[model samples]
Target: MAEQLEPETILREISDLEGRIEELRQAANMPVPDLRATLDAALVELELALTALRTMGVDQANAAGRSATAETERRVLRTVFQDAPVPLFLLDRDAGVRRVNKQAAAMLGTSPGYVSGKQFIAFCDLPARAALRSQLAAVVRTGRRRRTEVRFLGREHPVDAMVTMARVWIRGEPDPMIVVAAGATAVPDGPADDERPTRTATPAAGTAGGAAREAAPLSDDRDDEVMAALVHRMDVLATASELLLDEPVFNENVAVRRCARLLTAEMTEWVFIDLTPPRAGPASAGGTGAPGAAGHEANGDLRRVVVMGQPDEHGEETVHSLEQLAPEPGTLPHTVFTTRQSALRPHVEDLDLLGVCADGQPACVKMGATSVLCVPVEDGDRCIGTITLASRGEHGPLDLLDLGVAQRLGRLLALVIRASRLYQRRDEIAVSLQASLLPQRLPQIPGVEVAGLYRAATHGIEVGGDFYDVFPAAGGGWGMVLGDVCGKGQEAAAVTAAARHGVRALSGWKSDPAEVLSMVNQALLDEERFVTAVMAGLTVGGEGMKATLASAGHPPAIVIRPDGMVRYASSGGVPLGLFEDFEVGTQVIELAAGDTLFLHSDGVLDACDMSRRQFGQERLLEVLAGHAAAPLQEMLNAVEQRLIDYCDGDLRDDVSMLAVRRQPTPLN
Candidate 1:
């Protein structure tokens, strides 16, 4: 600027001046030289072409830095998209593919190079294209993620796909929509776009579609309903379990009835169970007909048949034979009879096949059942029976789970049945033992009318412990004894026999009741076992009947005069086996003519009612008073009836009574 110079030289000088000013401004706080000043200075060198060089150099440097940054960013993005497993794509403002990764290309059955610049709809199959359009538009407007499933048409087949949408921003422009896709096969039936967003669909009214699908709002709302049903099933099973363990109600028939009722209620249908033996005749002969008029053969192998659901018009119950239900020779019912086990027939023309059909006919024109399931009821290792469940109307046949439950139920029923039979056998054995041990008839004694009664306990199979004896005494009087042992069964019966023999042997030694009991006590103590007993000796004299009674831990005897007056002979002593020094206590009472004396074992007072309340001594005494003046047998019968009534028909202990009456001297 200080000298007149050539154009190039002038431009160089101006440039130098501008650089100095800028550097000074950086060192200080002054503003840089203005662009206008530089331009005006450069114009002075317009004839030299120096202005062009300075301007071009600055512009070139700026472009090079920007190009380097853009290249680095593009390289990083390409690597990220290529390695990602999920299908990824970038779309331009016009919803055209700007970039597509390998995953997306493979899904669409095309390459990235071919896919780029193509409209997103052009890549999708017809059904999915419409859906993608709707999803992208919604994503673009809302700036939120949207998702759907679609089917992409491949070169040779179609692939299921899951599409996701969200907004993405590019440099120097508003954010445009981006779409990512995945693939799945578990979609419900519809067009290829079943899971894909429809072309005209609006944005869903909530958060991301992924959140809604994962949580499944409708399914969550119905959870309680499903759980309630599960709880009800569990409750029913628990109730059945309780009933099975209840000894009082564990009857076979009762269990069967309950199980049938439960099944009927649960399935909402009629149920029929026929416990019958297997057929030995030809299948055609035994077909769907009433069992032969003759009762089942005594020697015939018997099997149980339990049929659930109502039979056809001909009334054929769902029948399954034991042999058909068994798995192998020795196996549990549930394990052997699986759900897949079935008896099959090709046509309904055969009688055996017809018998199984719902119509109970051998007509071939009718629609025949495809399969039938039979579950065997096994007890231990032997197949006792079969449980048959049927499918009717339009419902599919039973599966493994259904048959499994039935087999389990059959096993439970078998247990109940076996237990009941065992209980009955035990009861029979107990009654037989008691009858064999006790005296069936009483011996006639001089000057005395005696009647005796013995009743076994009704609780279970157990030989009774009650016993009574009427024999001659030393002084020509009758010795009567009644006593109860402490327990039941063979052991108690053995002790009872010992006690009776000891009393009879002692009667020969002395007439006094106390001396007789002393002898009996010594005899019982001599043996290993103990006994409780009451003994009475009555001698007929000129004036009246004189009686001496002794009790060893035995209840007192009751005497009823012919005049309707009642009295109790109270005598007590320690039970047998208490000590070697123990003694029998005695009480003497004169019986007027026609007086009757009653002696009984403690079992009479220990009887229990249905409510578990005992028929105490007070109740027995009152009963004896009411029947005081009746005939001996009538009095015994009346007492029996009253006892049974008071106990509400439940006798938990044995009862025995011996009655002795002094007849009026025949009025001689």
Candidate 2:
């Protein structure tokens, strides 16, 4: 049992109760009929109780009875607060939620714990947010009660209601908090849903200045709705950027798919992306696709690239069926793509706005979409594609806010697509340029089997500088030249072209390998670049083939016999294009039947594995010896495969190899 209250204390308690009842009466005049009635009945009962208390004055009532009456009044107030008919939020001065009733949590489609500590205004839609912030601050500063309309962004859908806010001072806190009461807006008798006037939100403006303002008058709550929608859109763009840019290489197809999946998660129930083929001409500098603007149609029709829906049992089947529906001309998606503009239809009266599905059912009807928004994917003034967004009844219909967001997203995706295509074109050009630098075919020399291979390093987009050539030499002999320019890309390719052609031309009359290499060095000296090369002059005799090899700071040539015998031939010399009198390493060897010679660039020896271990000369020798008994081309293939496998397919430089084998039986 609690201690008895003094007469003075009892009087103070009566005064507090009377003040609370009066406040309740003032709040009861709200627009909600059910809440007003409840408050009115509670006010009457409270007045009756106060009258009885007054009748039993401090002189008549004992201290213990006064204590019991105070306790009973507290219980009634607690009951009223917890079981209020409408949603209520208790917020600190900063508008941070301190508590939310069950109705409030239900309105947010979340648990009370999730709603607590969050900004109370964040729940309101964008347009309403700024106004709510001002209202909340005004109420806190002035201690005045206020009412305003708000559109709450519920997890499932949006809820529109009128909210009343009042300042509330708690016992332990120095500053007062705010108490917000929200009631559902009552609708007067009206026409059926089908008969209701269709309200279509205007698409975003084309100019920057126009984009800053709303086309239609924004209701107090609508502003908050717009802000919330904008925030959601910005988040989507940030995530899409991470997803698309994180790839080792940007793929347009993968980007669109990822974007579609992301939209289904938080923004919409269904997403469709359609793209036009890349144009041959320069992208058009067309209009902003504002309403009434002429369409900028691409050469090709729009092809459906992605389709996604919210997670459900039938989602996959629905996606697959809808994938068969392409956007024909005059359809919403096609029109948006052609016009480079956006379209927002809140109440989609024309079911065939999107083309029909295979079953002849209207696409929007099958997807259960009440509203749709389509925006063009534009790069600069040219429209590249279209993104169509829809939602089921779980979310509110797409409106002007959604149209603005979709348009911005479409523009973002267009930039990504443009970048991806540009990279692809660059790679293609590199490939074609690199191919043009190499020999189309190696000349067939009787009594000799010659094969060469060139593989570019896989790490970069630029062309490599490794080159090899086989050409006719004096006295019915063959000349082979393999060289590596110091760098890559066009600069190195230019030097490579000069060196390969110089050697082939010089070897025509200069049969001696040393003389041919020395002249080649002088020819490249003006290039002010470095090139390592090994040239071999082979003359077929009635007995066997005599080979003269000259090295210019190049990798040593490997000589192999049929019985797995391996030896190296190297004449250490400075690389070409460095010195006018650089020494040319020269070696002479005779190749009998079933003997082969191998020449390669330094790339094979420099290849590194994941552990950064190099495939050195010792490994190259072992590889050659292991495959010595194989045919010429097969042996080269085996060596190349071993080099790639040793480095786990990561070559540090371009690999080029030339192999010459003296056949056991001479060519007919």
Instruction: Name the top lDDT candidate.
Output: 2
Highest-TM-score candidate: 2
Write down the lDDT of every candidate, Cα atoms only: 0.56, 0.72
Off by over 4 Å in 2: 1-155, 158-233, 280-300, 310-317, 399-405, 666-668
RMSD of each: 30.4, 20.7
In TM-score terms, candidate 2 sits at: 0.63
What would the per-residue lDDT of candidate 1 be over residues 494-555, giving only the tens digit for each residue? Answer: 77788887788778868887777776666667555567788888787764788888898888
- Superposing every Cα of model 2 onto the true structure, what RMSD results? 20.7
TM-score, per-candidate, Cα-based: 0.53, 0.63
What tens digits encode model 2's per-residue C-alpha lDDT throughout 86-133? 677888877788888767776655567867877775566432343465
